[model samples]
Target: MDDLTCDVAIIGAGTAGLAAERSARSNGATTLLIDETFGGTTCASVGCMPSKLLIAAADAAYGVRHAAVFGIGATATIDGAAVMRRVRNERDKFVAGVEDSIAKIPDAVKICARAKFTGATTLELSDGRTVHAKAVVIATGSAPMIPETFDAVKDRVLTNETIFDLATLPGSVGVIGAGPLGLELAQALVRLGVETMVFDKGNAVAALKDSHVADALHAILEKELPVVLGVETQVVPDGDGVRLSWSGESSGERHFEYLLVATGRPPRLEGLGLETTGLALDDHGTPTYTRETMQCGDAPVFLAGDADHDRPVLHEASSEGTIAGRNAASFPDVTAAERMVPFSIMFTEPNVAVIGVVPEDGAADVVVGTASYTDQGRAKVMACNAGLVRFYADAADGCLTGATMAGPGVEHSAHLIAWAIQSGWTATETLALPFYHPTFEEGLKPALLAICHAVHAKPPPFRDDGFLPGT
Candidate 1:
């Protein structure tokens, strides 16, 4: 059997793994990257990019169908085959770009094999090889979690991982789960002329912690598709399709050509022989690791990306990978690094975004400023007047702490808020920034003004300049 040794060995060559390799090598540590399949990331392969492609297609169809609102009469005829073709074709180009990056890595440092932990610092490969490293990083990523109850209808069930493979849209789809993934796909499918319904046991959408924001998003999505929440849902096979029955707050039975499950994705740790690692693992089979340093307990082992389950987004994975890799390279003297502020965006129409710290409801010393798009100037002009946004700040200092919103162009607005929070800007300071007229960003002015008022820092009246009275 072949044996290899390296200063750092990383398992799973996904986003986090690749970043780890780059970081480790930059630290002057000999590194090796191993994966069963190379040149693919969850985002490029199935998660983010492809889903956005489908959403883009859906948006086109929706715009065409709703052109009457602009006094333009138009008909939208969706060709499901053509839509799928572009999604797959564009998705391939993205995957190829990632593969090209992988190709640039040195051949001697890349291994195409599944790795299982034989010890804290040793791995046995699927290709009958052994790897011993001074330090190890687990970036194995995650896979969809399918309930055993749905096993009976497995043939007709689809998850994000497999849904993109469809040659044409299904006649109808029953989506189980009302989180971001489910709602995003459900809206896209419905817009693309497929009858789609979403079911969730919880009364939430897009995983928004702020009930106000969640409710607004839920209502907006319901206008597009039947999003049934706060119900117990069951699925069973029905001829060539699947049948879904729900009980509790709402009771109903429906049959669709396929079932789409967006429940959640647990880390792919089942076959990695984690039991042999001698690390303290949680019930989810994930090793306990320090977030700042990505170190697992006191050992020279690290966990990053979806494997750590800290933050599953691509940027967070890249950051955590860099942390894990740097710490792994400097093992026995690892140092912690500062992490970025939390930020997440869902690509649903009137995009949903949650940034920084979401203050608890009615928390002391917390003030909230809200804006509704129903009457916002730009939204009214665009006929996209639907959804709401709320900003939270410390009442004592008016420091922008967090924001939750479901509104037109929120994907862009959320970034501005995140940057402001990270820069330690107060509501009044942010309000001093220029806001052009007839733009979605102008919608933020009212919310900032409200925060200034709430904190007794309202701008002086009759100021010729639009800037708020502040330092």
Candidate 2:
């Protein structure tokens, strides 16, 4: 209705915010998109994409060391600066390329300056501008949760955010927390001749997908890096090298030249003037939203990303952002929901990729099939490789429910598994599908053969094409 008015105002121009903008606009509403910055932590800077490029360099470095294993007799020196250069070059190319995430939407999505709530329906901008929308969405995402004890050690300590900014890699580093980020960075360092130590407070590699997959991943990591598990570290300063004073069954303190904190994450809603809005944040300042609407109890407001806490992930944030934006435009009734396949990856020594109905929170009765790289034809040809592929299915129907792999090119396979699970495809249906031979895709076939075993317990009758039975 006015220059400063719109049908929807979406905050945080990251994945979620951008997705929301597109969704709202497509539904025939003018939208204004605002963010303190674009792409937040995950996409633009230290998030998955750039980190992946770094991982690729780390892999190449590994190849240089193992060239003889590949039948090439040459020694190569790892150049850390060169690797960073490759990262910058790739990052530049990505930015120069068309960004589909922020490009081409139905309605006018204006980028506003640093925005904060001035009223229930109003936002104040950094440049003394004010905008009003029928509904507001906050998708501001998460930041690295630095532990209190580790504050003084930041000179020698770094978050995952700053680890990539190193011109020269550390000779030895202690990475706390064996989550995806920790493992990923550990592999990067270890591959580059850094004597890296990874510390997971738990069993060091309790994979979110399934324990079987975690075991395979553990085998892979054991060969590549030194790991300390089930020990809590009280991180403090100790000379040039920082000391991690830890005690458990084994009570002792260990020291490292550099310490990386990968404990967990807190919601990133600070400095946006939340105090002015009077919205509720948990003790950690994260917004509370129901799993259903993902809306705060406050009127005309929606939340997404790490802030929302349904699932703190890039894809999850993108999906939630879109839904929030669309609902903001619709206002009274929103049809969107948060159903996630949540394909996750850990770029460790033996990289892991997973998608499925995970084995947490009493999700029982899974029909699973396991295939390893050593057993698969493609893996033998790959020259130097190790890992496994496992698919989980509903035992009753043999419908493939989930899949996890810690093998080469598992990211691509995760997509396929996610599709199969979401489509409710039975294992037999997967078997009927022609998979190319001498490729990782064929590994799915053996998985189907195993699925036949599960079906035979009370086997389904064979079809005309000899499908569905255990024959």
Candidate 3:
């Protein structure tokens, strides 16, 4: 009800907003953090943690059912209700942690209400309170994208926002969009004994850029559940379920009790009243912002997290929030340069990972180094040898630039590759690092060696000799 003034005003109390708030405060700015709801975004509530819990449960069920590979005869049964209950229970703990963090922030500085921009440096709270600030950060985050075509079956359609809330698993599920979320959830659903299928307009699965890696993932996921790609899908109500028809001709239509639209997430920029800021909006309606500084424009306004739609992962969001917050607090005085290399991981069976600069297949400046689980001793022994890892390096300098892989332990490999790339490690130098025998990391050696060869880096005599047992 009163007019308040602060050095910085941070809209949205999600992960990015929280980070920005702390960073701005740490930088000696009187910061006010506002949000209609507390806790973080998709990661805590329904996105990352809950989905991973479901995936883990599904993986355990799959492993037990297929235990005959090691000559163990055991019948595994899954309780759909129990599995979902456990997922939600664990998911709540994470959500509680986020709330606890928000609780620790002084109440005097945090406002639980929708904030609308009244001016470039002013926010009007829904409760009639006005905030006149020197700088502002926008971190409103994003929401699931539901296509207009699915309006016929809107009641049956679910997104990550609602899927985890299911009290019981659907008898059948049709996941529309074979991106990371769709593919991972489809495989988990299949393992949980719920008949599942995935459809995506894009030819690629799990957002993989590398054709070879994408092909491998498509094949592997197809083995678990039907993956329909490169076709438009239509959903119509059929009794209590929904019947799906695609662009291509088919004799029959498939029906599912539930439909998951995991196509993508669009920024939540509807009600914030952006017209007051005079900041340019991108083609996607996202505020035009710089990657290096996170500044919306020449003004002391910033955008971070899913709001920016750049590298929407949690860690990247945090980094961007810190940058935005620090810069907002010190506008026109300091702007930090972006130095972190890009990194992303999809936690599916034999996780999918992309790190650094993904080069084109036949790029003249980059060389491709590839290795398959079929040749890796550890993967073969584990009976999970079904994927590939490919690394891209600067051909002229042999510096490791990027890596894309769909294989066991790829999450760890992705981290290592991202670190090496960020640290400017050459392929030869990475190959020289110790790789123990009969380990998944040993698989990386071959790829790095291939890159060294492509770059014409002469290796030491021991590596050249047939002395290596695995080689």
Candidate 4:
């Protein structure tokens, strides 16, 4: 067997792996990045980038069809084959870019073969190669979950992994699971003129913790497409497509030309041979790793990205990768710091987003500030007023804790809140920042004002003039 050595060995060359590799190398570690395939990931290949492309096309179609509200009547026709072609063409460019970046990394430090652990610090490749490293970082990503019950009808099931490869859109689709992936593609497909029905075992879509925000998003999505929530779905083969039967919130039977499964993604650990490391496995068959340092026990092994199942968003993956890489390079002396304020966004219509710490139920120290886009100036002008924004703050000090919004331009608002929370700014500090009028941001003013009022319930400190500077 061929032998190789490195200061840090990173498995998987996706976003998280790349970040870890780069960070390790920058820290003066001799890094070896390994992956069976290095072309793209769920993000570049099918998850975020390609999915957004499809969404953009669908949005255009939706905009044109809604132009009648602006007194401009026009017919918009969408060709399924053409839309898929455009999506593939654009998606290929992104994949090509990732491939090109991988190519730039010298082959001497990159291995293009499947690998598993032969020992705690040794790895065996599918080819007759072995790598010995001081530390290892498992950045292996995740795959879409396909239930075994759908095995007979697997040919008709479309996942994020295979949805972008479709030559043409199906006549109708039934989406299982109302998470980000399901709601996003379902809405896009519906807007593109495909009959779509979404089913979820839970009452919430997009995993919104705030009940009001969840209700608002559900209502908005229902106006565009049919959504069945709090239902368990059973699928079976029916001719060319599949038949679905679900019950809980409602009982229903439906047949679709295609079925898309968007259930949870478990950590991918099939062939990695984690037993070799002697690290304890979690109940989910994933390695026990700390989110703070991404370390897997005391074995000098780190896990990042979807493999860790901590925070699977693109930015969070990058951040975790950086920490894992740096810590892996440092080995037994690795150090980790507090994570940044958590942030996430789902790019649906009237985008859903959250930032900072979300308060739990019956939290007496929490105060909620609210606004509705239904009468917001910019939203009314854009004719897309169909959601709400809510901010949560510590009532004791007006410190912004978290926020969840289901309204137009929430993506931008989420960024603003993230920065404020990350910087430890309170509600009053954020509100002091200038907000332009007739803009979507101005809609946030009411919420901020409400928070300021709630936190300042007692007499104003300035009112005690005896101790004031002027007095």
Index of the highest-lDDT prediction:
1
Q: Assess candidate 1 and give its lDDT.
A: 0.90
Runs of candidate 4 with Cα error greater than 4 angstroms are 457-471
Q: Roughly what TM-score does model 1 have, to 2 decimal places?
A: 0.97
The true-versus-predicted C-alpha distance at residue 354 of model 2, in Å, is 2.5
List model 4 lDDT by residue over 76-147, tens digit each. 899999999999999999999988888888788899899899888899998888999999999999988898
Find the 10 residues in a row with the least total lDDT in model 3. 462-471
Ranking according to TM-score, highest score first: 3, 1, 4, 2
Residue-wise lDDT of candidate 3 within 1-471, one digit each (tens)?
A: 679899999998888999999999999999999998786666899788999999999999999998999999988788999999999999999999998999889999999889999888999998999999999999999999998999999999999999999998889999999888888898899999999988877888987889999998888878888898888887789999999987753324688999999999888889898988898988887788788999887888999998888788999889888999999999877576755899889988889999888887788989999988865778878888888899998889899989998898888877888889999999877766667777788878778888888888965445641325433
- Which candidate do you rate higher for TM-score, 2 or 3? 3
TM-score of each: 0.97, 0.85, 0.97, 0.95
RMSD of each: 2.7, 4.4, 1.6, 4.6
| TM-score of decoy 2 | 0.85
Which lDDT values do the candidates have, in the order given?
A: 0.90, 0.72, 0.87, 0.87
Better of 1 and 4 by TM-score: 1
Task: Provide the lowest-lDDT 10-residue window in model 4.
Answer: 462-471
Which candidate would rank higher by lDDT, 1 or 3?
A: 1
